[model samples]
Structure formats: structure tokens, C-alpha cells
Target: MGFDPYLAYYHSIDYGRASLASDLNPNEGVYLRREALKRYFVEYEGMLNREFIRQETEENTTFQKCFRLQTERLASCIQNTIPYIPFELGI
Candidate 1:
């Protein structure tokens, strides 16, 4: 089965229906997945920057540490989900 990220986000909320997003045509699904991944990486990069600032700041040491840990986990999850077909890929 293929996957369409936008359709999944937009249509999967309804009850008693299979995900139309997952049933997308292969080409469209791949394109949608690529775009979704790109957006995810952008957001992840922003989160990393925010986490870095939090680590550097002195306010809310405990909260900062927690956020850093959460950010790291999120980065790892995103990395794992991405297809590993390219060697020169950048975050």
C-alpha cells in the first residue's frame, strides 16, 4: 500500500473508514511522502535550534533538560523514518 501524507492528515480523522491516504496511487504517494519528509526535517531543524538555545540559557534548567531530551528523541525518530537511499543527504 502507498501513503499520501496530506490526504492522511486531511481525511483519516473520520470514523468507520479506511485511510484513503494509505491507498494513494504510488507516484502521488511517493511525492507526498517526500514533501512531508521535507517539511518534517524543516520543523526538526527548528526544534534542534530551539533546544540548543534552551541548553545554553540559564532559565528553567530542569525544563530545558527535559526539552533537550525530547528533541533528541524526536530527531532520532525522524531519522529512522526517512528512506536511506542517498548518501549525500543532509538534515
Candidate 2:
């Protein structure tokens, strides 16, 4: 919505989402950024899932909180990497 940091243009597509463009440096790596986000989110999900399996297991609240913050920042980095120009598809 606002200027995103790891900038990629987002829009609705029949595919469920649309990606229009990006401003990532060749070395900055959108691929790496995407992988990192996926890894962090998966880790968070695993932590919560483990809690369900073992009631009093590590109580991963602290790591989850920290990971949540990291994901937000990483998401921002991905969002702001380019200009998000949107246009209507059926115009």
C-alpha cells in the first residue's frame, strides 16, 4: 500500500496474486529474501505445533515473538525493494 521496501508490484490475479515488477539489485537477491521469509514462517509454525504436541515444551514464546518481529522487518525489506505500480487488468 504505502511505499514497500523490498518493492514488488502487487495486484489481484486469477492466479490468486500478481507480481508486476521489482527493483532488486542483481546481488541483493529476491530469491534469497523469499526463501528467508518462508524459512522464518515455517519455523514459527513448527514451534507452535510442537507446543500442541508437548504441553509444557520449551514455551517458545520468546523465539516466536522475536521471529515475528524479524518476519515483519524482512517482509518490509521485500516490499520496499521496488516500485509497486498497480493497474486494472480489464481496463
Candidate 3:
């Protein structure tokens, strides 16, 4: 039998094999994923700047904070558009 990949992967497991007729709204899942990504970026930025710097100068600290903020903003933009971009998942 022919099966749609999106239905097979995203719909089948959650609603069960026979209940394909009933599917939850996709918006909630999308929102949850986006929130998770935001949390991940927050955590990642903290981890990246945890190492000691050779120069304990105010300028160095300011530069690191600015860099992390920019990186986080960029990550947020990317996550917002992730749904429009097609991606394949590996099992």
C-alpha cells in the first residue's frame, strides 16, 4: 500500500494506525517546538561563555555579552522560519 511520508511519520504514531481520520491541530506542536528551540539557545549561550578568559578586562566581558546576544537573536530568526524549510529526519 502507498503511504504518505508526512502522515506515516507525524500522524500515525500519535493518533494510532486506525484513527488516521482523527488528527490534532499542527499549530500546537509547532509552537511547542519553537519554544523548545528558544530554551535551547538560552542554555547554549550560557555554556559557550562559561570558560575563563585570558584577559579579565571589562572590554572583553562586554564583547562576549554582545556576541552572545547577537548569536541568540540570529538563532531566534532561524527558528521562526524553520517550518517553511523542508528537512528530512533520520531514524
Candidate 4:
């Protein structure tokens, strides 16, 4: 959390650019109809709550939990100079 959003490892630093935020942005543009949007949200919510075995913790975890875990992991990596492992969604 003490990270400088503009400072990035793979991306070049530039004026008014948030490289970290840009790196986390969705790669695809989302465009959906009303019904499709509803369906998408339903699936998205389901995915957020979906449980899976986390390799690091060896316990079932949801997307929301993984996000929190990854955030903490990143913070630890930054503070302690440990390697940060990115989260992977198998689905």
C-alpha cells in the first residue's frame, strides 16, 4: 500500500500516468446488452463468491479473499523484498 502507483517495473514512468493501475485494467472492452449485463453481473458475483483451493494457504478461498490476500502479499513483498506471486484464476 506504500507503493507509488506511477512507478512500475515493466512500464516506463511518465507524467500523469499510473502504470500500476493501468497494468491492472481489463484487457478487453466490455459491451453488453441489458439482459447480457444482468447475466454478466450474476456470473461475476458468482465468481467473486466462488471457492477454490488456494495453494499458498491450502484452503478454500473466494475471489474477494484472494484479492485481499494478494494485496497483503504484495505489501509484504514490497516491505520485505520477497518475490510476489500474482494471483491466478483457474477458471
- Kindly provide the TM-score of model 3 when superposed on the true structure, using C-alpha atoms: 0.23
lDDT of each: 0.48, 0.46, 0.48, 0.83
lDDT of 1 by residue, 1-91 (tens): 2233444534454565445544444233443488899998887766545522233343433434555555565456556884323211122
Candidate 4 per-residue lDDT over residues 25-64, each given as its tens digit = 6365568999999999999999999998987678888988
Per-residue lDDT for 43 in model 4? 93
Q: Which ten residues in a row have the lowest lDDT in candidate 2?
A: 17-26
Off by over 4 Å in 4: 1-21, 26-28, 88-91
Error of 2 at 40 (Å): 18
Ranking by TM-score: 4, 1, 2, 3
* Model 3 Cα shift for residue 50 (angstroms): 0.4
lDDT of 3: 0.48
Q: Estimate the TM-score of every prediction.
A: 0.25, 0.24, 0.23, 0.60
Which of the numbered candidates is closest to the native, going by highest lDDT? 4
For residue 41, model 2's alpha carbon misses the true position, in angstroms, by 16
Q: What TM-score does prediction 2 earn?
A: 0.24
Give the alpha carbon lDDT tens digit for every residue of 10-64 in model 3: 4555433432333535343444488899998898778667654324342334335
Each prediction's RMSD over C-alphas, in Å, is: 14.8, 15.2, 15.4, 3.7
